[model samples]
Target chain A: MNNHENTAIEFNQVSRHFGEVKAVDSVDLTIQDGEFFTLLGPSGSGKTTCLRMIAGFDHPTSGQIKLHGRDVTNLPAYDREVNTVFQDYALFPHMSVGENIGYGLMIRKVPKSERNRQVRAMLELVQLPGLEHRKPSQLSGGQRQRVALARALINKPKVLLLDEPLGALDLKLRQQMQVELKSIQHEVGITFIFVTHDQEEALTMSDRIAVFDMGRIVQTGTPSELYERPRTSFVASFVGTSNILSGETAQKITGSAQNISVRPEKIRLVAPETETADSFCAADGQVTAVVYAGMITRYTVALAHGQTMIVAEQNLDDVSKSVATSRGKQVRLIWPCSANNVLQDPE
Target chain B: MHYKNNHRPKTPKGLLLSAIGVLLFLHLPFAIVMLYAFTTDETTFTFPPPGLTTKWFGVAMGRPDLWAALGLSLKVASIATVFALLLGTLAAAAVSRSKFFGRESISFLLVLPIALPGIVTGIALRSMMGLVNIPFSFWTIVIGHATFCVVVVYNNAIARFRRMGDSQIAASMDLGADGFQTFRYIVLPNLLTALVAGGMLAFALSFDEVIVTTFTAGQQSTLPIWIFSQLTRPRDRPVTNVVAFLVVTITAVPILLAHHLSQRDNL
Candidate 1:
């Protein structure tokens, strides 16, 4: 009965081991109530496992899991007041959309008329106003996904655990759902613990993200903070893309550099003779490669000390002519010293 | 409509003829029975059935013994199918949902009754029943039939359970349904078609079963037993043909229905 109303979930030194494999190692985490938090990681990095633990599909091998400061490590999923939107949707193929959405209410013995009204309202909330009678198998993939969301949301649990719900949709449809999902969370005002491998999806939707690598959280911060000021090389490269400068090359760029990282977009490509102010860091190199993407162009510069630095520039100018001439030319990559983020080796 | 432009390999004419030949060889006896059920001849074999008449159908329907045997056969088949459905589904759930040691071996044993010879199963049941002092009766016959009927259901149930996966059950629990509620709402609906298909096949198998029923039904006559006993009487040939035709129809319909149900959901 220990109540911390503002804290939705807490994992205290939790570890989950599957025989010899440590799927989720000793980890301490807290997700604030009503916040859209994401666990970002590649496959097998324990993101989904962590989400499952929160939803009570999995239990910690040691330590504790608390929902609102009440220990729930030994509780089964049915006992926990949390719901999950599964990655596969997991909609019952035999049930129609309305039946699936109203299942939780039916279990609670809510009156039939009330259940139906709530189901219809949930369908509308998910933007699927008239698909209540269609079976899960009859709907398209995205429609099935919406039904799954509506089903979990109808119960109105304290927290919603989503395990890569947008992974199966097409890119265009995925982007659309991402916005819808964020808005739905905002409207519902329930804590959402989302797990995803896509960094852009995490950045676009989550209020804060915990980056996971090798069964541990590498860093946790706001999307902009994680992207701009990564604490480790793993977080720097994973959240977005960053060029890590270390050893002698880093030492020459910034005096006595143990390790430092700067984003590719942060460094500007200029003439080799460009003068650097005291507030800026500059490196002279030959442009070894030019990759012209639709929205941006990337230049790979080979420094005199043999370290390559990537510089990305927005395609604001007519860059097609410059793309042909940029390769093999001497260039100076310049960025304000504030753009450099000091890095630490991952544990 | 035009297969010549299709990329699939053309089916050879010889293969098609041989397939037809095999089907004819397999079903030609049933077609002969169908033809003779309407024969005018009361006794002896005759080509082309000599002439056709609907009298044997009426005659077969009039016999009290035929009705009694048919009723008993239906009763035994229905009861045996129910038993098979319950036991087989439990065994399938246990084997498919858990990872206990010897899971594979246990499932293998569950299906062994059907794989073994029917005579062997009959003898084993008879010995066990006698050892337990359980007198041979209608219930004994049902118990005997259910042994192999369970195997048919187990196969169907296990395959469907594997395809259904555990995600829906997990989803059910996460949505606040307890274990029994999850089974009733989530597991049962998903398993309905598979169970129906399995039960139908079990009914068909149990309906015309003679060997096990013969060993278990002491002094009683089921439809199959009556048909087997009538084969020795020359006067009852025409009536026997009609009854055989009825038996074939009764068993064939459910088998076909089971096949249809099982094949409908490949997705």
Candidate 2:
């Protein structure tokens, strides 16, 4: 684990209130140097607000923010060592692609020749070379996103903030840019604080993910850690699909007064006559619904005495007609004890 | 491409006649003025003037009063347009970007100068000048013109600001640009064409402004004021017609140019 001095950004009890709305509640977090950290949540969940404070677009109403171990809570955006790739790209319409990319250098009084060289180099870094004089209006959506990234990365700031930078692209383009953006972060070695609401995007590229909810960070961990061992029901259901167990059914399974979650993939279906392992928890249920997704079949099973759970099975072999019609049939649902993860009831 | 007879909507004859009737009603007098500028009969409005000539053009150009009034009008219009552009853009930036107490009223006050009767505005300005004990001079004329001129630019600027949401400026700040630098590089470039359109319209409006200029211009003659004085003189009727023709062209050209520019921006 990295020490405290290696932290690139630290939010210390930061909060921003707008009259009656707490746009960002007290958020305390430390982003490691050269890490790809994501702030993931739904819209109006304060993910973007936290990113704005780090970028110095919004000052916290109370508490402090440190950049590279220095207090910069009140510093203006220009003085901060960070750049952002905006969601809409926001390229200057009046300037050519080259001028837009080199704008930061121009603002800092860099000479024209050096600025052009850096712009060309940055363009190449984003895999867009030699198409400098074209206007932003003429470019396609994906091309404009690349230009936006190149423009922010040209400055080589300590951190690159991305606010849903791939949102404007279609799904195929978004997937392609996700890979490209991850590789770019690796090459630049800059701490990147990305804000996105898409769970798939957060899972794919982030080294660490912070799930925000209603102006607060609910959980922060590596992608798999968040998925497998969520501390709360919100994190469990939000990070991935989980079958939540509550009421007396949860007490029967865990032998404690607690709620629990089990991943759909971890639950298995077996005939009642089959012998079970001692380490596994077993339940008798009838399949209520069957969902046939391409590579998997999902079963919505209702356990005896009323709790419903979802179980997913990979199509390891062809599902015969008998297996497909098991929607109304009785079955034994079994999963290893390790798969039963206890979750705290949400506050 | 020619429209197919089957696809075209048939126009009623009454509507067609009314369209031309409205066109003639609006522009016929201006056409008559242009025709009179070329007439040989200087003192009378005879049918077709018996002959067409270009002598009044030279006569109007030779007068010193024409030169002084033309120069003063140009100067006043320019100064007023500049003043309007600066204040109007700032007010627009504030109004469009921020939500504050009485924001709607601020917008209302900015536009009220042009929306109210021009004579009422003129009276208010004249009385304000009297209360402040500020002597009426060239600056007073400029202030009066700007009271209405600012609204022209303000309307254009605020519409533009609303279209360009807050994300652009956020991106600029994120790219490490200070406020002034962001305005110079991003905001100003995007705003240039709109400002040009609004500025030209303001200039056109200020150049021929009469009521406000009457209250503000103390013993000074703008081109419109000079034209008002020329109306009663029987001998200089042809020269008056020539100057009126020039005024119409001067004002109409900018408005046309403004329209063309703003239309191109939309595309």
Candidate 3:
């Protein structure tokens, strides 16, 4: 056990089951202090369950959880020094913005004047200044989310758990909140455990991320580390899009009969007869389909061995080497051999 | 509240006539009762009275028996409403938040008192009181009224609990509040409006309740029991009409208030 004050939260083989369904299987992990860590997974991957157990809203079916190096598995949420920003921004509809932000302090029986001052300060931090008198129902979705953040942050908990806090916002607002939330986490210097299924969000703001699947933690690493060197097929395919190669094609590409992953962005478009470079692996294929996505174009290349790979390239201003107009053209797919990540053998 | 653009106000002529006809059919008798309370003649029905006077209202107000019955009814209804609010909210919170064995059956049983024929509930309560050798009195009337009032509050509160969603409670807990604190700070506020709506409806129903009260009250004289007995007496007819008007107003106020309170939440 690496129990220490620097570790904000640690799970020791914690598992939770609801009768027939195993919501979260035995999992071990540690979140360090003042680090922005994210749990990334699709729905039903048990990431939210893990966050709930940490917040003390749930108890593990077996094993233990420690908060700030103290065993809090049996502790209630009120006793735990952790707060959460919910997905729907669960602000009290009846209370004004200031009252909602000041709720935690009010519950703690803080002085009225001090609570108001702290609420105002927290509101300013979230950039929703001087709107405390307005009801949550009257505010827009983005403003309500900011109030939720302020309310949770005012408690000044050791760790803040954000469960898809930006899920309710529109695309533009979500991107904007992403940057603001990251900066606020840095400013507050609280250990943050953010949960999201959006891989881009995880990659953008997280100092490190844990990928989950089927009630287990598949991999844990920095965003680039997981993106560039996923140790398993699920992590490789889930973190960012990857062209998975196995069987004979895997042997031909890397001289080993092992599953490997090559990212679509890593493959470059080259001439049909280009000679393979010492540092890069090369293969010949026919461009079967092209998909235009405004700034970039993706080509589905069907190799000689009946395997298909998706290759994406920037749609530069020069129109000559464009994949959009290169349909049915023979091409060579090449990427640095070092870019290919060998995944563990499938069980 | 901003539904002006969505209004489809052009009702068909046939539907409009039918709606008006239905409203009049339901309310015309109550209007007649109000009209009779002001009739000058004591024992006769007239198309237009020789003179309309407020003398019956004065007579009804002066009677000591009438005051006693009104006081008893108000006391019973208030006590019944209090018990209903407590037990109904507890039952709703349990059924809505936790999925345990027999949850559906418990919910169905909670609503059974109101759904079944009042005579059936009266007979059931009366027989149980008899088997236990419990004397029928003011307390029995309150208990009888509470049986159905609990259903009213439970129905309203349970629906609100479901619509309020589960995340609000989770959010409260995650915000450093325990179960009691979560209820006080989060759950209670959301349900306060709903509880008010339910409590008012329960009060209105208990105030006007007649059948169950008759079986439960052995010697106690409630307002409805007095009204029932007075209907058989020929001399106090106009006074009975005046008291009926007062009862109708007392019951109508809470129903309308509950409607207004619950509707405001939709906005």
* TM-score of candidate 2 chain B vs. the reference: 0.94
User: Model 2, residue A77: what's the lDDT?
Assistant: 90
List model 3 lDDT by residue over B138-256, tens digit each.
89999999999999999999999998888888877777677888888788988998999999999988888889988999887899899999988888589999998999999998889
Stretches of model 3 off by over 4 angstroms after superposition: A1-5, A318-325, B1-17
Q: Tell me the spans in candidate 1 whose CA falls farther than 4 Å from its real position.
A: A1-3, B1-28, B54-72, B117-143, B211-222, B263-267
Residue A279 in candidate 2 has what lDDT?
92
TM-score-wise, the better of 2 and 3 is 3
Q: Worst ten-residue run, lDDT, model 3 chain B?
A: B1-10
In the order shown, the chain A TM-scores of the predictions are 0.98, 0.96, 0.97
Mind giving the per-residue lDDT tens digits that candidate 1 earns over B200-230? 9899888989898888899889999999899
The candidate maximizing DockQ is 1
User: B5, model 1: CA deviation in Å?
Assistant: 15
Model 2 over residues A226-279: C-alpha lDDT tens digits?
Answer: 999988888888888998888788778777758889999999999975678789
Best by lDDT: 1
Q: Rate the local accuracy (lDDT) of all candidates.
A: 0.92, 0.91, 0.90
Ranking by TM-score: 3, 2, 1
Residue A54 accuracy (lDDT) in model 2: 88
